[model samples]
Structure formats: C-alpha cells, structure tokens
Target: MNSIGVVYNNNHELHDYILKGFPSPESPARLKRILQHFVDNRVLENNNCKVLYPANVSVEDILRVHTADYFSFVQSRSLSGGGWLGNDTYLCEGSFEVLLQAVGSVLEAGKAVVTGQCDHAFALIRPPGHHACADKHSGFCIFNNAAVLARHLQHVYSCQKIAIVNIDAHASDGTQNIFYADPSVLCISVHQDPSDFYPFKGFIREMGSMPALGYTVNMEMPQEAGNPEYSIFFEEVGLKVLEQFCPDLVILECGFDSYYKEKLAKLNLTVDGYYDSVSRLRSRWHTIVLLEGGYHDDLGLLADVVLQALADNRYTKDEVNQVNLLASRQSSCRRIFDNKLNELKKLMSSYWEI
Candidate 1:
C-alpha cells in the first residue's frame, strides 16, 4: 500500500473571507468539512495514511513564481484590514499568515513526495491559487501554489520535467500564464468550457507560446459533461499527451467543482469521474495533489474518493448512478462535447499524435 501524506492548513480559519463583511463560497468551511470527514470516518487512521506538518516557507520560496512587488502588496494588504485585490479576490486581516501556511503546506507535500517520505501527498489548504498570477491576485487566489511547488521541486529535488494537470471546473489561467513560455513544465487543464465560465480564457487555441508550443493543453468540456465524457477525454487526449511528455512528477490541481452537484459550474463529474481521473494519473506518476476549488456540500465525499484512488483502494459506491445521471442530460450536451473533443484533437494534431 502506498503511504499518503495529508497536509492541512493549521490556521486556515484566520484567512476567512466572511470576516470581511461578506459570505464567500471559498470559506474556511471547505477545509473544515474535509478535515471533519477525515476524522469521523477514521481516514487518517488508515494504516497507509498519515498527517504531515508543514515548515514555514520563506519569501525566497514565494519569489520563485511571484514578483517581489506583488508579494509586498499582498502582505501589506493582509496585514492591514482585508480588501479586494481586483477580480473579486479578498485578503482578510492575517490572511498573509494563512497564505504562508497554505504555501508552506503545499511545498511540504511536494517535498515529502519527491523525497520519498510518502508515496503521495495531498495538501488541503484554502484560498485556492490556480487563478493567481505572478503579479496579481484574482479569483480568490493570492499566490500560485502549484507553480511555486513545481519550481520548488525543480530547485530542491532537481526534477527537471514536471506536469501540472488541473481537474478544476475553472480554467488554470494563472498557472498557464506563468509557465506558458517554459518547456520544463507541461500544463494541461481539463475544465468546463471557458466561453461562459469565470476566468473565461482557457480555449483550445491557447496552447503555450513559442518554444513551448504544445506544452500547455486545455480541453474545454461542454456544460453537463459528466463521467463518460471525462473518461473519453482521458483515454484519447489527456493520457496520450502525458505519456508523450514523460514528466518526473505530476502535480494535480484537484478541484471538485466538476462534480454533479456543484452550483458554480454545470459539469457533472461524480465520485466515479474523480476516482478514475486521479487513479489513472497516480498509476503513471508520483502525484502531489493541491486542492484548488469546489464549494459543494459533498466536498468531504469527494476528498475521500480522491484518497481512496491515491491509495489504490476499492472505491466506495457512488451516491448517484452513472447511467441514470448520463441519461438525464440533454443529448445536445454530449453532441457539444463530441464537437469540442474533435476540435481539440485537430488543434493539437500538429503537436501530438492524437
């Protein structure tokens, strides 16, 4: 059995957005639910799973991906009373401290996996960072957590080739922007079509620029694309591209917004969809999963599904039937998905043999 290292943001509550006079869906409740589920279900008591503590990360570590000026701005803003940093991103008082803890936990998880302290690790930190850029904060992200950890792996462990795969419903525009010109990291985001989604820019044509032309891949699943569509994507494009890239480590920007019940997005990835996706990626490479987004009440259930997949354990029966769910969707949903898939294949044909 592969040992799974679970990293938590010990002081995550301090970064709560509700204290800033608003009820944000990216509340501290997200982590609270996941942690509570683990305790109640004895998830950590599993022989193959254990909790890991994170060390404080320094400014140098953060500077690997963020500019010094932006770092200072986030820190100062969080030090003072919290305020919006454009694009609906907020940083409450002491959020800077929580931000460090979040980044620290992510870096610690990466360190544990790369150094063989654990076969795999999951950092259940808050204030998701996928939408954050080097110089600005957006979509509730203060720093690019995955990007920072990816750079840390390369610097400390000498991991030259890495892949960051995002299963989040929203596009990983920030992470892509940071690594678009670099070939060392391959960024693939499988998300709801960004045409009508938040951060609406992860189109199929937005592959990496210049020398890293095919390094970044984005698959825009139509609204209501459920388990079947995700599986097809994996078998056809996702897996094939990863196989060709041959990364040393795979960092999963795991998010549950693609789940069927999510309010923010219309994608319908259930327990089975998440398990299949994470398990397949785990089967191929050592994965360090960093929680990104997912505001549904079933966050706990989905987190358990991910842990089971990581440990190679049999999955618990999904609460919903895959067949019935698929049958309920409009036929046009699948038609739209098929068209998008074909277009993705055509766009990447010059770069990959899909």
Candidate 2:
C-alpha cells in the first residue's frame, strides 16, 4: 500500500454562509461529516496514512495567480461584513482567513507528495477553488487552489511540468482560464456538459489557446453518464493526453458531486468509479487530491473511497449496486456520450496522438 498524507483547513467553519443568514449548499457541515467519518472509521490509524494541518499562505503566494486588487477586494469584503460576491459565491466575516487556510492546506498537500514525505496527499478543504478566477470569484470558489499550487511548485520546487485533472460535476472553468495559454500546466476537466449548466464555459471547442493549444482538455459527459462512460473516456482520451504530457505531478480536483446521490448535477459515479479513476492515476504518478465540489450525505463515504485508492487498500466496499445503476441509465445517454466522445477525439487528434 502507498503511504498517504491528509491536510485540511481547521478554520473552514468560519467561511459558513449560514452565519450571513443565507441557505447555501456549500457549508461547514460538508467537511465536518467527512472528518467525522474518517475518525469513526479509524482511517488514519494505519501506518501508511498521516494527517497534517496548514499555516496561512503568504500574500505574495496568493498574488501569483490572483490580482493584487482582487485580493484586496476579498479581504475588504470580509472585513466589511461578508455577502455574496456574485456568481453564486458568498463570503462570511472570516472568509478571507478561510481562503488563506484553504489554499495553504492544498499547497501543503502538494509539498507532502513532491518532497517524498508521502506517496500521495489529499487536501480535504472547503469553499472549492476550481471556479474562482484571478479577478473574480464564482461557484463558491474564492482562490484557484490548484492553480496557485501549480505555480508554487514551479516557483519553489522547480518542477518543470504539472497536470491538473478535474473531475467535478461542474466544469472547471476558472482553472482552465488561468492556464489556457500556458504550456507548463496541462489541465483536463471532465464534467457534465455545459450546454445548459451553471457556469457554462467548458466546451470541447474551448481548447487552450496559442502556446498551450491542446494542453487544456474538456470532456463534457452527458447527463446520466456513469462509470462506463468515464472509464471509456479516460481510456480513449484523458489518459492518453496525460501520457503524452508526462507531467511531473498530477493534481486531482477530486469532487464527489458526480456520485449518483448528488442533487446539484446529473452525472452518476459510484464508489467503484471513483476508485478506478484514482487508482489508474495513482499507479502512474505522484498525485495530490484536492476536494472541489460536492454537497451530499455520502461525501464522507466517497472520501474514504479516494483514500483507499491512494493507499491501494480494499477496505471500502461499493454499497451501490453497479449492475442496477448501469441498467437504470437510459440507453439514449450512452448514444449521446458516444457522439460527444468521438467529436472530442477528432478535435484532439490534431494535437495529441489521440
């Protein structure tokens, strides 16, 4: 089994929206349940796993991917009494501190894996960052955690190349924009089709521009697309591109919203699907899994599945009946997925051998 390190921002509760008298799916309870489940299950009792806390990241580090003015805005907004930052994002009085801790924890996870302190690391952070851009915050994300970590690795560790693979149900629009023209970082986001989805931007045609064309890949899984669809796409396109890029490290934007139980999105991924994806990536590269978006009761269970995959352990059993779930999916869903997959492959062929 591979050794795994885990880190989370303890102050995540400070960023709660309920304190601001609003009902939001992104809540402190999300992380609370996951941590509680981990403790209840003795997830860290084994020798192969270790838990770590985080220190606030410096402003200079935050400015690497965010504008100075935008950083000031978040800080100022928090101090003045947090409210919605537009685009479905909210901030409480202490959100600025929470953002710093969230980013710091993600960076710590990356450091643990790259420095050989652990074979892999998982950052169980909150206020997901995949949707946050340099100057704007959206989809409950404030700072681009993966983007900052990618830059940090390059600047501090001299890592030449890094690949970010996002599996959130929603598109990773913000991360794509940040690295759309940079070749050093290869971003692959597999999410629900954005034709009629929130933050509609991650289309197959939206490949990276100029120097980084083909480095940014987006797979728009059709509604009800499940383990079978995800597996086929990875085998045919996602994994192939990563093979060619050959990144020094892989940062997985691991989101549980793709699970069948998620109400926010219409994609179906179960424990086995999660394990298969993580295992395939873990087998090849040193990975850092950062929590992105998912608001469901099963978040804790899914987190365990990820840790099990990273550790190469078979402790968590699949509770969902895969056969039934596959049987229940509409036959038309597969047909739609196949058409989209073919189109994506043809488009990507001009860049990679896929």
Candidate 3:
C-alpha cells in the first residue's frame, strides 16, 4: 500500500461564514464533518497515512499567481471586518490567515509527494480555490491553490511538466485562466455543462491561447451524467492527453459536488466512480489531491474513497447502488455526453494523439 500524507487546517473555523451572520454553503461545517468522519473511522491510523499541519505561506508565494493589488485587497478587507469580495465570495476577519493556511497545507502536500515522504498527499482544505483567479475571487474561492502549487513545483522543485485534472462539478476556470497561455502546465477540467451552471465558462472550445493551444481541455458533462460517462471520458480523452503530456506530477482538483447527492450541482459520481478516477491517475503518476468544492454530508465517505484509491487499497465499499443510480438519469444524458466527447476529441486531435 502507498503511504499517504494528509494535511488540513485545524483552525479552519476561524474563517467561518456563520460567525459573520451569513449563511452559505461554503461554511466551516464542511471541514468539521470531514475531520469528524476521519477521526471516527480512523482513516489516518490505517493505510500508513500521516496527518500534517502546515504553516502560513509567504506573501511572495501568493504573488507567484495573484497580483499585488488583489492580495492587498483581500488582506485589507479581512482586517477591516471582512465582507463580500464580489463574485459571491466573502471574507471574514480571519479569512486571510485561513487562505494562507489553505495554500500552505496544499504546498506541504505537494512537498510530501515530490520529496517521496509519501507516495501521495491529500490536502483536506476549505474555501475552494480553483475559482479564484489572478486578480479576482469567485465562487467562494480566495486563492488559486492548485495554480500556486503548480508554480511552486516548477520554480522550487524544478518540475518541468505538471498536469492539473479537475473533476469538480463546476469548471476550474481560475486555474485554466492562470495557465491558459503557458505550455508547461496542462489543465483538464471535467465538469457539469457550464451552459446553465455557475461560472459558465469551461466549454470545449476554450482551449489555450498562443503557444499553448491544446493545453487547456474542458469536458462538459450533461446533467445527470454519472459514472459511465466519467469513466469513458477519462479512459478515452483525459488519460490519452496525460499520456501525451507526460507530466512529472498530476494534481487532482477533487470536488465532491459531482456526486449524485450534491444539491448545488448535477453530476452523479458515486463512491465507486471517484475511486476509479483516482485509481487510474495514481496508477501511472505521482498525484497531489486538493479539495475544491463540495457541501454534501458524504464528503467524509468520498474522502475515504480518495485515500483508498491513492493507497491502492480496497477498504471502503459503495453503499449506493450504481445500477439504480445510473438508471435514474434521463436517457438523453448519455447522448449529450457522447456528442460533447466527440467534439472535444475532434478539437484536441490537432494538439494531442487523441
């Protein structure tokens, strides 16, 4: 079994939205429940998993992806009694510290993997960062965690090629935009169709620009699309691109919102699907999994599945019936998914072997 390193903010509640008298899906309860489930199940005790606490990252690290003005704005707002920062994102008095901790934990996870301290690492962090861009925050994200980690790997660890695969229900627009024109980093986001969703920007045609034409890939899953669709997409398109790019490290922007139980989004990835996705990636490359967005109660269960996949262990069993879950979706979901898959393949053929 592979040893896994787990890192999370023990004081994540410091950035609580409830303390600000605002009720939001992105709350401290998300991480609270996940940590509780981990403790109750002894997820860390088995599988040779080590829990790690991270220190705050420096301002220099933050500036690697975000502009100075944006960083200052967040710090200032956080100090002056935090409030809304536009794009449905909010900041609390302790949000800045929380953001630093989140980024720091992610970096520590990456360090654990790159240095061979562990085979893989999972940063069970909050206030999802994939939506935050270089100059703006969106979708409750304040810092682009994956982007910062990618940059850190390149500059600090001398990793030349990095691939970021996002399975969040919503597209990873911020991470995509940050490395849109850079060829060193390949970004692949498989999410619910952005047409009728929040942050409606991750379409198949939004490939990268200039020198990195085919670096950015977006697979739009139709509503009700579930395990089969995700499995096929990864097998046919996602894995093929990864093979071509041959990244030194693969960062998985894992979000449980794609699960069938999520109310904020409509994707049907059950425990088994999540396992298969991570297993396929971990089978080939060193991976660093970063928690993105998911407000459901099943976060703990799914997090277990991720750890199991990383360790190549089969301790967790899927309680949900996959057959019935798939059957509940409209038949047209497959047809729409097939069409989108074809379109993506055709567009990608120019850049990759797929």
Candidate 4:
C-alpha cells in the first residue's frame, strides 16, 4: 500500500476563546509536530512515500460542490485575516491558503488511488471541512474536503458512482448537505446522534430528499458507541450499502473525534476501532482518506495507528491501551449495537438489497 500524507496549514498560534486568553486549541504548529511524530515513529515515514502539493484549490474546484457566492464570501473573509465564521472555526491570514492546500491535498489523494499511483492514500489536512455545507460554513470547517475529493473523482476522473463514508463523531453535515440532492454520490455518516451535539442533524429518519432519496444514510451512534458497534455497522450494513451503490471509488471522511481520548465528541472508539474500520474499507474499495476532525492530545498517535491499519490491511498489534475498550464489549453495548444495527437496516434496506 502506497499512502501519502498531504498538509496545507502551517497552523499559526491563536488565543483560546473559551479559555478567554489562553492559546488556541488547534495550532498548525502543533499539527506539524503531530505529523512529525508519526513520521519519526516509522508509522508513515518508514513506510509508504508522501507527496506535497501547493496550497491552491481553484475557484472552479470550489464551485463544483460549493456555491459560487459562498466561495466568494469565504475568499473575501480570507483576505481580511479570517476568524470565526462560526463556532470552533477561525480565519487566520494563512487560513485561505491552508484551506486550499487542504482541498488540494485531498484532490491529490483521490488522484493517487484512482490512477493507481498507490493502493491507498491519506490527506493529513487541517481546517476540518465536514461541517461546512454548500452555502454555509461552521464547526471549524470552511469547505468540505471529502466533498471536494468526491467531486474531483466524479467530474474529473469520470467515476460514475462514488461512496463517501464519514466516521467523525460529529455528523458530516456539510458533505451530506452538498450531495443530499445528487444521486450519483452516496453520503453515509456514522456519528454521534444529534440529540445534543454540534451541527445536530444526522438522524436515522433523515434520509435524502426526493430525487435522491435513500442515497444519504445517517447511522447516528449513541454517545460512547464503541468498536463493536462500528465493526458491526461496517460489516453488516455499511459495506453492504457500498456494494449496492457500486461505487467506482471510495472517499473516506476519516475523523478521529470518535476516539475515546477525543474531547470533541463522546463516542468511545479506541485506536483499534479506527484500524478495523479502515481495514474493512481497504478490502472493498479504492480508498482516499481525508482527515476531518479529532481534537485530542493523541491525534498524532491515533493517526499513526490508523495508517498502520490502512497500510497493512489488518489491525496492527494493539498499541493503545485496550482496557476500557474491552469493557465496552462486556457491558450493555451489545444490546445497543443490536438496536442500532436493526434501525440502520430498516433505513438502508429500501435502497440496498441487504
């Protein structure tokens, strides 16, 4: 497996708003350091090679999935030193370039997989995009990176069918909103339920609208839903949907927010869960992995574990502690899993054969 990690943001420093004077939670410098740790550990640097692309996502590329007016608005704000288009998002002077680079990196990832330059690739981008919709931007996302890559494959490469799977704890609201009306791209989000979460949207009942009904699948995992449920969803329902959709290529909106260590969302996915999910996808479709959101101290560590799975096509020796992870399997988690899987089948069955 030849996987590449592309980055655009040199995340400069910012003061933390909630901390009301402290440093920002997300720093490009920190992201760089985290990526470096992955390289140093031989998780990435010792294995598949990497390629860097310039931070320039064309306006036309932006217009493919986003509104021309919204593109103009984000660009205009980017000119004046960007900051907070909404919660958890900010526009630094370099944010415009950073965001473009992020999209460019994802586009490059798609190119690698589709062209067979590599068996798989990961775009280690910043300014998370899953939250940004077609006309609005929020939740630290200005533009949807996964959506960008999907459109790149569908339009430029002539992929007739595409499947986008988001594993972020928060719903892939932006990606979902963009393709909600398009039947060609299948958008499936596995995230924390909207009962009380940021950008509250992904619900079991919220399938796609008319003309594109059943194309949008939202598997809203209850808070603290862990590896078992994730695996079941992928093996039983999720992958089956992919088979039914018959995508030419797969674009993964891979987010680490579901990691037990992450503070952004309450899902309890361990590093092992991340590995298993990627490994499953590796077997089925040509995958383009784009980072979405994961605000935890161990972003680098978790990222390394995820790459291990993608490269090896199996779970690496359990590096992260698995104590609590096992406990989830022993608890009432199975009941929850059964219930969620049953609900998911009910929603996806109408569209998928299984």
Candidate 5:
C-alpha cells in the first residue's frame, strides 16, 4: 500500500491572520517543510502520495459535532474578529477560511485511509482542533478536526468503530466532551496532568458517561514526564486497551507539543519514543493523522520525525537527560498515577470490562 497521502489546501494561507503583526502560533505551514523533506529524501517520489482538497466542509458535517447555535456563533465571530477562544486559542478575521481548510483537509485525510488509497495519511493544516468542543473553540482549535473526521467516517462509509489517539501535551477535552456519550468512537488522550495545564481537565476519573462509560480514556502524566513514562504507558496500557477495542480505523491527534523543546507544556518525548509507538500501531488499522498542536521553532524537524516514524519505521532520537528527568519528577508521581488508574477502572466498569 502507498505509505503516505496528504490532504492540504494551498489557499490555506487565506487563514493566515496578521492581526497583532505576528503569525498565529497555529499556522498551516507547520508541516509543509517536513512534507518536502520526505520528497528530498526520495521517501515520496513515485510513491503516489497525493494532496487531496475538498472545498469548505459542509454545514452538515460541522453540525455532526457542534450545535447549530455554536456554529452560527463562530460564523459571526469570524466577521467581527476572534481572539483567545480560551486559554490558548486565537481567532481573527481570516479564521473562517483557516477553519474551513482545516476541516476540509481532515475530511480528505480520513477518506484516503478509509477508501484504501493509502496505508497512512496526514492532514497538514493549521488552527489545531482537539481543543474545539461541540459548543466552543479553545486552545488554538477551531473545528475539532479529529472529531469531525471520526463522525464523517461513520456517517459516510458506515465505519461503526473508530479510535482517536491524542498525544498532545494537553488533554483532548473537546474531543472527550464530544464523544462522552457515544460508544462508537473511542477517545484516548495521553497528556500532562490537567492539574497544572491549560484546559484543567482530562483527569483519569472522567471516563465516558452511561452507555459509553469506558469509551473515553485519559492518562495524565505529571509535568516533565518523559520518553520512558510515555512508552511504558503505551506498552502496558495503551496497546492493551486499543487491541481490545479493535476499531475499524485509527485517527491520531498528532500534536508535537510533548517534545522537550516545547514551552507550552512540560513533557519529554524524543523521536525514538514517537517512532516506537506509531510502529507498534502501524499494522493494526489504516491511520489518518491530523496535526493538532506544536509551536516550537523546530516544528518542521519534529514533523519530519513523525513522517519518518510513520513511513519508514525510522526516527532520529533527540539528545535528552533521561537520568535527570526520571530523578527529578515528583516523588508522588507514581502514587498519583496508580490512584488515577484505579479511579478510571471504577468509572469505566459500567460500560466496559475494565
């Protein structure tokens, strides 16, 4: 199968807002250079990789994960102006165009995987979406890209089972809220504990509600959580849980903020950790990766790491102080983690065999 497929819009630049005389942190070009790297490396030449774009996402698609009123509110907000949707989100006059392209790319990305066009696809667009809830926009997100694609797959192609894996340093609160009561979509987020993060949500105990109790899973790592911690969770828990769910497809909320260089949140995931995780999941199901968050100046380099991991089972490890990081974490981190796991088991038992 062709290893890589892309969904992008050149006009995505239309969403580039120059409000405060600075580029938005969530820009469309974040992954563009990395895509080119694959080309320079001959990783994409003659491979049939593609850039698929659809026009603005249909209103029906938008409403699948958002209330009409909220949708209209954002439409109007686009006209007047947009600002911090919440702690990390920002919106401006051009946000609508950006938002549309974001959703459109996501839709096309999922379509490529579901339709057997690619073993994996990446939707590289901006204004990251995991933080955008059905009712509101926040955390630099506008349309909840991953959520929309999950629903679209279900509605368009009869994909009844879908899994969304969010690895941003911040929890996917908006995604959890959207799928809280739905059984068909399983949302798993691994992020720094919300106790000291932006959204201040994604606690372990906040599993899904009745009928979907166990579908939403969260792992809250302590600040400065590093590669070893992330890999252990995936090996011991993430793989175990996902193997049991057996979704028809996997949608990754692929955000790079967990890197050590990122200032937005404290987590230390080197490229080796990333490569191993994706490699483990590579054969399970087709994957559609949506770029969600990551604002470091080295965004392109990290993006290349992700593509390498996904396409060739290869990644360049970053130099890290593993010994120091492990020793420096809170003495209570493990204790807190165990308690969180117990709470999650108790909460999810009603709907799943936790």
Candidate 6:
C-alpha cells in the first residue's frame, strides 16, 4: 500500500483580503471547502493517506527562486499596511506569515517524497503561486511555491533532473521564466490557449532559450477542449516528451480551473480528464502535487480525485458522463485542439523523436 503524505493548514486564512475592497475568489473559503470535504469523506481514515504537519521554512528557502530585494519589498509592504500588489493580487498584514506556512508545507511534502518517507505527497496550499515571478507577485500568488520546492529538492536532497508539469488554466509563465535557461529542470505547461487567456503566453513556439532548448514545453488547449482532447494530448505528446526527459521527480502544478464548471476559464476538462492525466504521470514518476488555481465548488472533489489517483486507488466512478459531456461541447473545440496538437508535435519534432 502506498502512503500519501498530506500537508495543509487553515491559518492560510490570515492572508485573506485585509484592506482590499473586493472579495477575491482566492479566499480562505477555498481551503475550507477542501479540508471539510476530506473530513466528510473520511479521506484521512484511508489506510494509504496520512496527514503531516510541516515546519515553517526560513527566508533562505524563499530566496531559492525570488530576489532578496523583491522579498524585502513584499515584507515591508505587508508589515506597514496591506494594499494591492497589482490589479488581481492583494496583500494583508499577515500575508507574509501565511506565505511562509504555504511554502513550508510544500517543502515538507517534497521532503517526504524525496526521502522515500512517502510514495506521494500533496500540499493543499494557496494563494496559488504559479503566477508569481522571481521579482513580483501576480495572479493572487505571492511566492513561486513549486519553483522554491523544486530548488529545495535539488539543494537538500541532491535530487537532480526535476520536472514541473502545470495543468492550470493559465500559462505557467512565471515558472517557465525562472527556469527558461536552466537545463537541469524541465518545465511543461499545458493550459488554455493564451491567445485570449490571462497571462497571454505559453504559445507552442515558446520552447526554452539556447543551451536549454526544448526543456520548456507548452501545449495550449483550445477553449472548451474536454476529456477526449486532454487524453489524446497526453498519450500522443505529453507522455512521450516526459519519457524522453526522464525526470527523477515530477512536481504537478495541479489546478481545478480546467474543470467544466469553472467560471474563469473556457476549457472543459471533467473529473475523468484530471484523473487520467494525473494517473499517467503517477505511473511514470513519484509526484508532489501543489495546489495552484480553481475556484469552483468542486475543488474539493477534484483534489480528492488527484489524491486517490496518486495513491493508485482508481476504482471510484466519475460523477459525470464524459462521452455525453464531450458531445455537448462546441464543435470548434476539438477542431482547434487538433490543430494545436499538430503544431506542438511539429515544433517539438526537431528536439524530441515525436
């Protein structure tokens, strides 16, 4: 039986909007819903899952990816008075502390998996960090949690050749930027086509720069692309690329916004889509899942599904009928997805055998 390590804390609520005029969807309730769902479903009672409390990480850990000047600016801004870091991101007086805990939990989860203490780990933390960059926070993210954890794994555990796979609705622009020139880390972002999406990047042609060419992979899914499209891309492109890269550990930047019911994004990935995608990765590498984005009510459900998949418990039935769901989507969805997939394969053919 594979034991899955879980790290989380409700104190992340302290980072909630303090002086921001608007109520952001990335609120404390997001964590509450997932925690409550775990309790209601007795997820902790499962023999294969264990909850682990994490130690607070030092500022040195934060410096692994972020700049010292930027870190000081965030601390000083939050310490004085909470204000908007940008249009979408806000900061409260306690946000820096909350941010520390979030990073700590992620590190603990990574430590568990890297040390063979657990077969898999999930850090159910937020103010989602994929959008946060080396110099500043953006998209409700204050720190790049996955980037920090990836660097920590290499620094402390000596685990070289890490892969960060992002399945969020938005491009993992910040993460790709941080590792764009580094050859040791492989950054693959599969998100909604950024032509009309937020953080309009992750185009098919945005492979890594010289010396690290083809290390950064981005596949832009067409709007309304659902289960069938996701599965096809994974089998035809995603899995093959990862096989070539052969990472020691795969860090999933898991997000629930790709679900059919998400309010912010147009993609139509259902529960089954998420399960198959994660399952494919689990079969190949030990994975550490870090929460990124997803605002719908089913965030808890999807999180549960991800944990179950990682634990190799794949018997649960999906609540939605994927065939009927796919039939209901606009015809253009599949058409656009096919074109993008072809473009991605062609672009990557020179670097990879695909």
RMSD for each model, in Å, please? 1.0, 0.9, 0.8, 2.8, 2.8, 1.2
What digit string (tens of lDDT, one per residue) describes model 5 on residues 167-226? 988899999999999988999999999987878999888888878878888988876766
Residue 279's lDDT within candidate 4 is: 77
C-alpha RMSD between model 4 and the true structure:
2.8
Per-residue error at 82 for model 5, in Å? Answer: 4.4
Arranged by lDDT with the best first, the candidates are 3, 2, 1, 6, 5, 4
Candidate closer to the true structure by lDDT (higher is better), 2 or 6:
2
Model 3, range 75-194, lDDT digits (tens) per residue? 999989898766878889998888999999999999999999999999999889999999999999999999999999898999999999999999999999999999999999999999
Model 2 spans > 4 angstroms off:
none
C-alpha RMSD of candidate 2: 0.9
- Model 6, runs deviating above 4 Å: none
Candidate 1, backbone clash total: 0
Model 1 lDDT tens row, 1-354: 789999988899998877887667899999999989888887766627878888689899999999999999888888888776668788889899999999999999998899899999999998899999899888988899999999999988899999999999999999999999999999999999998889997899999998999898999998899888989999999999999999998999998999999999999998888999999999999999999999989999889889988888854787888788888888899899899999989988889889
Give the higher-TM-score candidate: 2 or 6: 2
Off by over 4 Å in 1: none
Candidate 3 has a TM-score of 0.99
Global lDDT of each candidate: 0.91, 0.92, 0.93, 0.76, 0.77, 0.88
Model 5 worst lDDT run, 10 consecutive residues: 14-23
lDDT, model 4: 0.76
